[model samples]
Target: MFVIVGLGNPGKQYAGTRHNVGFDVIDYLSEKHNIPVNKVKFKGLIGEGFISNKKVLLVKPQTYMNLSGHSVLEIQNFYKLNPEQLIVIYDDIDVDLGKLRIRSKGSAGTHNGMRSIIYEIQSDQFPRVRIGIGKPQKGDLSNHVLSRFGKEDQEEMAITIGNAASAIETVVTEGVNAAMNKFNG
Candidate 1:
């Protein structure tokens, strides 16, 4: 079994924001697979189905973005799964818009949600597919992340989120190395 977690704040206001890119990506994946996120479990809204012939649990942390680790740890503990079996999808501020980065393992950089997950889980050994939302040109980062994307960013965000979804699917079926080679480069 493999677990895929998408981090984001819960609420209508944060729906299409850059920080919710992870949620969007997982939504796309779930929609494509016809898996509805109907169950509230493990501190998250879970959609269960098979991705690439592997049992997959698509988790959208309802605990919101910053406290994402609470939901993740619950799922992690319940499944007795290792860190390597987890794939986290989240937004990145460094990479260019419309770009996707598939990493085997790395520090959270500036993402508070990921930082919290790392702090709670006590490891950064999990695979992650980062959907780039780009850096802010003005205003605070928190504002930028919480705010919706501009017209220019909308198209790019759509494309990047789709790519991120595919990259995660690749990880589910092919293992971290294959996903890294196919998506990272």
Candidate 2:
């Protein structure tokens, strides 16, 4: 089984924020694959279903962004899941808006969620899909991520999220390298 985790803060206040882009991508995947990610467990929401003949456990950490590792570790231990079987999706401020970057393993950069996951998992060797959210011109990043997207951002984010979700499907079926080539254009 594979644990597909989307990192983000939970609550209505954070619903449409850029930080929730991971959740957005997962929602797209759930809809496309007919999986209902409504089951709550391991301090997150999860849905179990088959995709590409692989039993996937879709997870959205409810412990918020900073403490994301708590839930990830819990799920990992309970399922006896390894880092290789975990695919984390989240927003990236470094990349330009609407662009996505996939990596097998790398530094957390400035992302707290990724940092926390790496700390608890004891390894950064895991697949991740980063949806670019873009940085703000000024002020705190936390405020920026929690803010709603502008009109232009909304338009681009739709296509970005949909494509990212498809790319995730590709990863499960066609492998990471192939999906990267197909999606990272």
Candidate 3:
């Protein structure tokens, strides 16, 4: 069994923002696999189904970005799964917009949501797929992340999110190394 977590702030206001791209990927996977992520538990909205013939739990942490680890820890403990059985999806400002980076393990860097997860879980040995949001031209990092994409970026993001969803499926079926080889450019 595996747990796939997407970190994002909950509520309509945060929807479609760069920070919510994780949630976007979760929604894409849910729709693609016909899973309903309507269950409220583990401090998140969860759905269960098979991906690549592996039983998997799809999660969207509802505790907002900074407090995401609290929710993830609960789910991880409840499922009795190891760190390696987990996969996280979130945005990264360090990479260029529309790019994706897959890593078997790494530090959270500037992402508070990922920092929370690593702090609460006490390990960094989990796989993660980071969708790049690019750095802000202006210094207001919060506003940049919380704001929705412009018309042109929105069009490009569709492709990035689709690739992210495919990457998750690859990880489940082919393992992290193969997925990284295929998807990490």
Candidate 4:
């Protein structure tokens, strides 16, 4: 089974914030695939189901962003899955808005959440789908990430979230390389 994790802070307050793009994509996937990601397990909300004939666990870590690795590590150990079976979706402030970057494996650059995951898991060989949120023009980093998108950006974000969901599907159905080739710009 493949474990697809979307990283974000939980709670209604974080909904629609740039940092919650991962959650938004997971929501899109849940709706599209009929997976009810409401069951609490492994420190996350998870739904066990099938995507393109592959058994999958859709996960939304509820431990917030910084502590995401704790939940992810638990799930990884319980399932006895290799790092390759794990796919993480999160926001990237370095890329342009509404864009995506898929990497087979890489060190976490500036994302604290990704850093935590890599540190706890002890591997950088997992697949990841990064939804670009773009850098803030001028503001506190936390404020920029926590803030909601503007009206125009919201429209772009809607499309990006949907695409991110589709990218996850492709990652499951095909492979990371295929998804990257198709989705990455």
TM-scores, all candidates, are 0.96, 0.97, 0.98, 0.98
Span of ten consecutive residues with least summed lDDT in model 3: 176-185
Q: Comparing 2 and 3 by lDDT, which wins?
A: 3
Best by lDDT: 3
Cα RMSD, each candidate: 1.1, 1.0, 0.6, 0.6
Better of 2 and 3 by TM-score: 3
* Per-residue lDDT of model 1, residues 1-185, tens digit only: 88999989898989998889888988998899988887999988999998867899999999988899999989888999899989999988887777888888999998889998998888999999988787888989898778888897788777777778888888888787887888775
Per-residue alpha-carbon lDDT of candidate 4 for residues 1-185, written as tens digits (9 for 90 to 100): 89999999999999989999988888888888899999999999999888988999999999999989999999989999899999999999998999999999998889999999999999999999999998998989999999999998888899999989888999999999999999999
Candidate 3: regions farther than 4 A off: none
State the TM-score for model 1: 0.96
> Candidate 4, which ten residues in sequence have the lowest lDDT sum?
24-33
Off by over 4 Å in 4: none
Ranking by lDDT: 3, 4, 2, 1
Instruction: Output the better candidate (1/2) by lDDT.
Output: 2
Give the clashing residue pairs of candidate 4, or none: none
| lDDT for position 34 in model 4 | 95
The CA lDDT of each predicted structure is 0.87, 0.90, 0.94, 0.93
Candidate 2, residue 11: the lDDT equals 94
